[model samples]
Target chain A: MPGNRWALRYCGNMLSLTIKEVSLALREGKISPLELCRKCLKRIKKTQHLNAYITVTEELALKQAEEAESRLLQGVYQGILDGIPFAVKDNFCTENIRTTCASRMLKDFLPPYNATVVQKLLDQGAVLVGKTNMDEFAMGSGSTDGVFGPVRNPWSYAAPYREQSGGAEDDSEWVITGGSSGGSGAAVTSLTSFLALGSDTGGSTRNPGALCGAVALKPTYGLLSRHGLIPLVNSMDVPGIVTRSTSDAAIVLEVLQGRDLKDSTTVQSPTSHAGFSEDFDVRNLCVGIPKEYHAPGLSQETLAQWSRLADLLEGAGARVREVSLPHTQHSIVCYHVLCCAEVASNMARFDGLEYGHRSTEDSSTDAMYAASRHEGFNAVVRGRILSGNFFLLQQNYERYFLKAQQVRRLIAEDFEHAFSAGVDVLLTPTTLSDAASYSHFIQADNRTRSTQEDVFTQPANLAGLPAVSVPTALSSRGLPIGLQLIGPAFQDGMLLSVAHWIEQRVGFPSISNYEVPNK
Target chain B: MLGIHQIYGRRRVQLNIILPLLCRYYYASRTDNMLSTNVKTLRKTRNTPSRPVTVARLYSSNKHNSKVPKVPTWEPLGEDRIPSLPQVSSDLVDKLERLALVDFRTKEGLVCLERAIRFADHLNMVDTTGVEPMDSVLEHGQLFLRGDTVTEGDCAEKLLPLSNTTVEEYFVAPPGNIPLPRREERASMLKHSEF
Candidate 1:
């Protein structure tokens, strides 16, 4: 019956409807929740070789869908996401489901309780499709650290092009699916899940979104409950959304945002205002262009693409001003020190004595701690933890850790000052360069290159402000380049609104190379 | 505050121990001619008279050296010599009682900073200055030790009138002569050792 229903709705096998469109179709009797869920599962099965998911719960998903269909028939829809299927980054806890942070540490551990975000989605009748793969402990800037395997760039599957000179040349370079939200990006791009939730401490949400050619929004810190989402840094971490479109991202965010008692960091601020889907007037809005973000080394093509975006906004009657955030240069260093220090402290709880994988060696307590951590953490995570510990050491704490906090305060003040000067949103490139190939990312020089790319995005994270990466143009090489829109803290709705407007003005390429079949 | 004074007193004792050594050596050289002669002879024999005689030699002097009076080396008290009983001040006890009279009275605020630092060092949570970062240590300490008591039952009901009694007698009851669990049965008991 569900197969027949999907066949009818997806006539000609070309149903590219978003989660919102699918929900509306179900409500109007054009399709059923069961039908939509089955189609999503079918798509997942077809793309299984893509290695996007760590675990797929087909049986649990169908059982939940049947319940949702029963509710739909009874006219008792829970909310917008009811019966809509979504995926969560494996770092999030799911009751009775294997919630690995794509590390062997949690390979067999099952959380007894669900993360607050997961519970909220499930309560709204969102069927969980599967847990997507990610960097171990959400540490890497690429998905290569995952235990399952590195998630390949879907854009890499594009067919070779004929050279102007002679023969066909293969252009299938393995693009880096920016991480630690890499799998979330891949899930949406590969159409395995309509939407996915990810935690962004640094640029985990936006980086992957830009790389995978998806719409990602990192909500303002303290706007969403982080009770169950394991933290990298408590002060900076925020739950974000990755989806096919800005509208779908807005829908998922609206459902996920609110004050939770368990998470004391969440505050009742004015930016927590509801109704994000309402019409947004961007004609009179002032968008700031930080001169520092337009530094040298930005690819010529990306700069050209940015100029076009500026012209498009100016044509739409929005004023673009060149603003200065003087403290932007120090944000990368400050973020690394603060985030790594917090990582060192927060991750100390997994001592193998309490939870996670334990070493079988009969060793002393200190040896056990060392063995467990060495066995549990990957290279990137261990490097960061070591770096953080070094900073927090007696000889270096004040010089690095305290100074980093001072710099973080200055960064936040910079944003506050800019906003006070009448800028509604700030625009910058999501990355300094286009997504690098996986091979390039492994080379020694790539570390410096990646850190430089993060220079534009790290300031927003340092300020704990809301930011969204909306793909604006493709590189000359046909790779996607993103334009970031940032807003004041708790102004998630406003940021999303501005992004939605930009999405309308300059349409992004949502379908990457793999999504298009061979002609 | 009392714990602070105790630590300050300990530091003062250490200083006292070092100060008397200098004074005793100086007085011995000035008043005792035979000892001074022996010191000179020893220095001359060693061929390094420019170097000051170390304090270690003072403690190693034999009783047979009649000119040198046998100086007693003071040793700090061992753990067994010091009382193990909990020493709650009357003022603190009365304050706690008065505070408990209020329905929503806050918990005790008396924190031993030295103990806190030791705990932080034990857990390897120290900051760059070789000092325990006070914020996190205080947080973890408050979580672990708040509302905890040395003895069970209400302090007011059990020990209020017995203020003159020593802590060991007033708090700790006599152990009953019950048979202990066998090693086989007690093997699982180790799991509950966390508390």
Candidate 2:
């Protein structure tokens, strides 16, 4: 009778567990570490069809969970994440493990060290479930450009798969996971991991977060280290966290945020606000609405959602006003020039020499360099490299690179002016529209012509500010629409505080709303 | 304008003074002649001090003779006349023996010798401070070593004997024997040299 009672208690405890809940359960001796790991692995296997992970180290995870169980029994539990399972974008280096960055070039490369963020998470006793796939070198707006394959939208897992519906047969019907952090978002949504780390150059983290119905925070530039991240652009790339809730993202940020000696760009600052998980007051907050963001392409549904958000905030006693960012028009051009120039410089080191896949021929040095690059890199990456090199050439350097720098300065100044007008936060859509199908994304004029869709997101990257993408509404077709809140530099906590308040008020549905179809 | 008697008396007194002036002029001329004779005698005896007296007599007898031997101010020494010195001293030999003993005891002397060898090696590698002995070979011009040769001057036909050996040899290769051939010929040679 006692055994039966104990078994029932254990089963009841194991159901519906979060990180904190699991921690409490472990502390109370209601469940063993082996039991927790077993349940998580079972859930991961059951949802494998969601395609959330590129590699799952079941053996390693089980071994680590056993060690964690021993420590817990000895009353030496590490912290809140003592036995939690998490995943990271493949771009982040994991020691002695393959980190492909979803690109052919690094398809076989194994780093000798871990990314600082990954190292921190592991040190806090977080068990790594696997490495998630991402856009090729984290460059695309959709996760479809990966060398392995496109990551499907978890929201579309239960949607009816249409046959013979479109222009290109190959790209006919799958919904985009909204890259370049799409895999991280999907992994968390599918419950493959409690938290995932992703890099955000220009809305990569937030766009995927919005689309996958997860909470992702793009921390202030240099707030976290970028040492082991395969950089897209050194100046603007920030390693961010994507998780199921704002509190989870905050906990991951607290664990990973610090100054690292290997990454010189991360500035050493005083300790951030203690206990960011505490509730925040937003009654006197001022939210700014840039008139320019309401351009001609804003979908009626998105605009209506924005109006509803303003009304909700006003009802909650927050003041909202309209503002102008005069230099918003030049953001796309400036972003392309600067980002490509940086890409050209950063990619120059990957000439098939030290690591990565090498070419088969032992030809002349130039031939060797050229052949390896041509074989290793994909078409989109190659295009960016070429464009970056073109802008950085001697003749076009001043006209393209310098003009881009000037435009970047103007965009930053516009934000500065708006902030100086007593505005506490700025709100806008994460993207101009919701998730597009793969064919629509590929056939879109902007994707074919140039990288012009980054017009709204690139300015924040250029300015090196903090922004968070929180779901405000869902499309009629059941796609998540996110509203981003941009804050002043180094005010990430404040921005997150306001975002948390708005998240509570708006009450966006979690992944529980989406059903996982049985296989 | 004076009277004839005063003029005649003044003339007789002037004649007396004129007679003494003529006597003084003759004596001065005789003194100058004697001085010239002595100068000639001194010059003739200047070269051959051992035969100064005999050479003076010969010069007095035949002043126009061109067969007299002349003496030079400086003379060149032959190579065989240079002195030689011993290469090493007895004290140094004794010291070397003692150092050899120390070498047997602790190898300190061997280390010193090795350091000396290394120093010599460094010296050999360093550039030469003295004028290069092959400078004449490298430069295609009149080469001079320690100022031992001479060359042309401004005025023609005036052979200004150089004070030192300032002029060096100027080697001019025959036309066909030039080290660097013409460009076309060299190219042809290179083309034919290779298989």
Candidate 3:
């Protein structure tokens, strides 16, 4: 039996097992679904300072656990994910659950139906743990601006929290979990849940995946249905998966992906991938290092691991070459116009007249619209909505909106050109650096932060390619630094296979490997 | 929109056939065995991308193409030239307030609006000549349209109460006869909003 300290501080050691191990343990009758559910709830309470979860579905989870236990006893359990516990980002709708996108506007909003991905997981018998917090309506990059306070990095466990006696609200002291999907990343890394669903508009999932040392997968647009994911940018938004390993991500992706008639953008013809082989020779792989991803803010540590990982692949007999995506410099700017344009269109739905946050100050319909929007959305959301409309105006339409679309073509073609030149996957750094301290990060406003932070990852979004962030190494500050792998669209399985390869080779300590003493 | 090749590939395959095949694939690549399948490793041929629609960009026929746009006031990672945004005047912001229904009267709102515009202006640096504007990520704007039919119904019971301002089945809204909030009304609304 383990000592009290080891048992008390369960994570980072005891609960480090990935979904595969846990599934086997469950299958062998070594693990109880109810016990696992209770333990996860207990861990969530223990790490309340992290503030990773928005709401814990303890009652629903326990009920589901009982069902899972009964199914196992009857030997009629669903496949691999039968009793697996997972979390969904608050942005995804879970029927009857208060699915706030961490915004006051929808704090009391109960989703009428489950998001496609969430429903698919539940259908496969995966236990729904809770909704992870995110940037309100998934607007900001550094998950700090949400209505619920910023999610602190688990690596910052020793760092003082605001509510704690010695903790101060000084931002510089707290390490920010990279946003939008920051909570999902923190949850998976903290072992609060085995896998969490996140929506990646522009690196929201992968950004935090890097900071929190979890494997993040942003599947190709239309690969996974987006029926009920609260829309941020309709064109670019894709359901993202964060997990302990690339294999865990792949299994979840397989379960959740397919054509849903409700989502018109879903790819109609689903191709069953030829399974990945563990013994597939590295010589068959061709890796391209995008030259443009070496932008100004890239830290030395990130750059070195990026190179070191390439060297590892090369040593394994894979062909590695530096490739160029020249239009990358313009992608972030192009994304702003496109993303905001969609954000404007999507956000127009939040009038107080309909569901969600009606204002009492309704002198006129117009007054109600104005006041409700003002009260409903946070400043970041409102600002984006405003600027998006500005771009859509008749005068600026050609100059900004139309021009940005043309620029998006160049960005997409740049990825296409690189991939067409006999490259299998493009390897790049996910974030410029590891996670940023709150005080240092808040210095730049949200837009500027997203611009620099998403340089490497946004190009993949623009091209509609699949990408995954694999934690490659620890930074000088001992924070996790992840590198990204971008593969061609519709080649989702191949992308995961390559990610799984790097994942095994790097053996970068999983979150549980971090020897942080439990507070 | 799916390009030609993707559209051609995405035909209406029966879900029954797809499901069984999907199951086989899933069982074959179960999480524990996903990376460890010892299949005969064949040299995989690259999937050639067939359809090509030039990425979205403006026409080469524009007169202003001669005078290339330049980013006057922005740089990435916070070396901002000037965030005040003198180009966007108070009058322009007021007009935008009426148009977008967002508050810019506050100092914080003003600064945020300036930051967003200044950041967006960086798009001026890219010379998008001869590029066909990418209208959608899918090729030729391909959306999988199912046969038009009612996907859901009888949801008034579920959706109506979402807004407490509803009167019976009708969501209560201010009368349409009145115009949009005037400047003074907006000021009072802003005060009410406490922004």
Q: DockQ of every model listed?
A: 0.01, 0.00, 0.19
Residues A324-433, candidate 1: write the lDDT tens digits. 78766656656767776788777777656545765542224443444455566665565555455556767657766776666676677789899999998888778766
Candidate 1: where is the Cα deviation over 4 Å?
A: A1-15, A159-172, A271-278, A445-450, A512-519, B1-195
Better of 1 and 3 by TM-score: 3
**Cα miss at A282, model 3 (Å)?**
1.9
Q: Is the docking of candidate 3 incorrect, acceptable, medium or high quality?
A: incorrect
lDDT over C-alpha atoms for residue B63 of model 2: 23
Task: List, residue by residue over A1-519, the lDDT tens digit for candidate 3.
Answer: 212211332232335688888887766666767778888888888877888999999899989988987787666778788888899999999999999999988989998899988989999888998999889999888898899989888866532122121223333466888988999998888888999999999999999999888899999888899999999988889999999898888888888888898888898434565444445566788888777677776775576567666766776788888777777877898898888888988988888776788777767887778888888888789889888988898988987898999999998888888878999988888998988888889998888788878877877788788999998765535467899999888787888888888877665655453333144
Q: Which candidate is the best by lDDT?
A: 3
Alpha-carbon lDDT, every model: 0.63, 0.62, 0.76
For model 1, the chain A TM-score is 0.93
Among all candidates shown, the one with the greatest DockQ:
3
lDDT of 1: 0.63
iRMSD, per candidate, in listed order: 32.2, 50.6, 11.7
DockQ of 1: 0.01
